[model samples]
Target: MNLTLHVNSEQETLDLAALLATLLEPKDVLLLEGNLGAGKTTFTKGIAKGLGIETVIKSPTYTLIREYTKGKLPLYHMDVYRLEDVGGDDLGFDEYIYGNGVSVIEWATFIQDELPDSYLTIKLEPTGEFFEGRNITFEPTGEHYEQLVEKFQKQASEEGLI
Candidate 1:
């Protein structure tokens, strides 16, 4: 099933992402797709906060990947934009994707073929209503992800974050 949400501001987006993060378990993968300033990193920061991470979360645009292990479950944040220009698959990304942590990949389509059998894909699009407005679509690809999304929807609704 698919769930669509309207993000009114950065805080609302972060709140939704944090709520989703709470439902994630180890080995959970989040595929983030959006434009250059579409708030992918901000969402990841929210996930990090939900995971109980205290460290600063930065974009891995140039570094490709950043690992934050202080959280309940480690967070592996990856920006695969460079992969498109470099064009190679020798990074051994499976290690992080299947690791004992939650993996969030920005520009995931860059390595779509390398992804595992199941993962949650979040597409953020500009609504053009407000400077921070966005129409976020959550597409769950497996049983585990389906449950996760359901729980997120419930919590978000209860908390008025949806």
Candidate 2:
């Protein structure tokens, strides 16, 4: 089942992402879909924190990809937004996606053909009631992600965060 979470502030969004980060494992892929300024990078920073990464998390918009290996598990952060025009054929992103790390792809729609058969897609949207309020949905494409979402839901419920 898919999991939907509500957050009223930037911190809440970060905290929620951090909670989900705890359940991540190597080779896990998370596709982030949202409009500009939708907090994708903020959520990613929280994941880095949960993974024990000390380095500052920045958007890979210009760099295309950023590798953070100081964490318990490496994080391969990719922003495919720029690839919308050129395409992602020769980027060799498969190495990161299938590597011994968690890969988070922003603007994933730009590289849909490069994605694996299974992964989790996170969609964020403004709630309109509050400036910082957001509606986050976790859509799982396979068994692994399904279980991940299930565990996250249970944990968030127990912590009274969702």
Candidate 3:
């Protein structure tokens, strides 16, 4: 299923991500797609906060992956943007994608084939009409993910976070 939301600011994007983070479970995989300034990392910071993590969340661009275990569930943040340049699957992606932690992958399309059969995807794009406006699209692949999306949307609507 698919759901879309218009985020008016960076905080709104983070709020949305936090709300979705609350509904996530161990082993959950979120594929994030967007441009350089599309707020992917900002959204991830919110997820880290919602998961009860206290450390600063940053892009794993150079490091490939960052692990935050202080939260209720471990969060494995990954950046596969460099995958094309360094062509290989030796990074052991499956360990984290199917591991006992929540995996949020940035630029996931680079390694889409390595992802699990079921996962959630978030696509963010800037809306040129308004300043700080972002068009966020969600695509859930399985019943579990679909239900998670439904719950997030419901909570977001009730809290006026959408």
Candidate 4:
């Protein structure tokens, strides 16, 4: 199944991401595609919040991967934007991507070929300057992802998150 959401505020976008945290399991990967200021990291901030992570959530653009254990489950947040000139493998991103946490990659389009088959794909595009509105697309690539679609859609409907 596929799902789409239009978030009108940065908070709504994060709420949606937190809803996803409830549905995600270990080893789940999310390949986030978007341009800069597209809410990829903002969406992830909600994931951390939803998962109960207490540490600050920031882009790993320079660090490659930021691990957070304060959440319900571990979250491996990665950013590959700076690596367009470098190689993903050189940074050993595969290890974190395939690890036991929920790996969320920002600017993941840069390394699409390396993405796993069971991952969920999220595309966020700017629709306005406020950063509150977005054109979002969700594509799940596995049975686990199907559950994710069901859960989030139901959550959205129940919470009016269209």
Tens digit of per-residue lDDT, candidate 3, span 27-54: 9999999989888899899999889998
Candidate 1 Cα lDDT to native: 0.90
Error of 2 at 146 (Å): 0.5
**lDDT score for candidate 3 against the true structure:** 0.89
Which sections of candidate 4 miss by over 4 Å? none
Of the candidates shown, which would achieve the greatest lDDT relative to the real structure?
A: 2
* Candidate 4, 1-162: lDDT as tens digits: 878778788888888998888888888899888888898889899999888997989999888788998778899998888778765665666777777778998877677777787889999988966666897899998888888888888887897776
Candidate 1 residue 35 Cα shift, in angstroms, is 0.5
lDDT of 3 at 86: 63
Ranking by lDDT: 2, 1, 3, 4
Per-residue lDDT of 34 in model 2? 91
- Provide TM-scores for the models: 0.95, 0.97, 0.94, 0.90
**How far off is residue 69 in model 1, in Å?**
0.5
Misplaced by over 4 Å in model 3 are: 86-88, 129-131
Q: What TM value does model 1 have?
A: 0.95
Measured on C-alpha atoms, candidate 2 has an lDDT of: 0.93
Local accuracy by lDDT, each model: 0.90, 0.93, 0.89, 0.84
Which pairs of residues collide in candidate 4?
A: 8-132
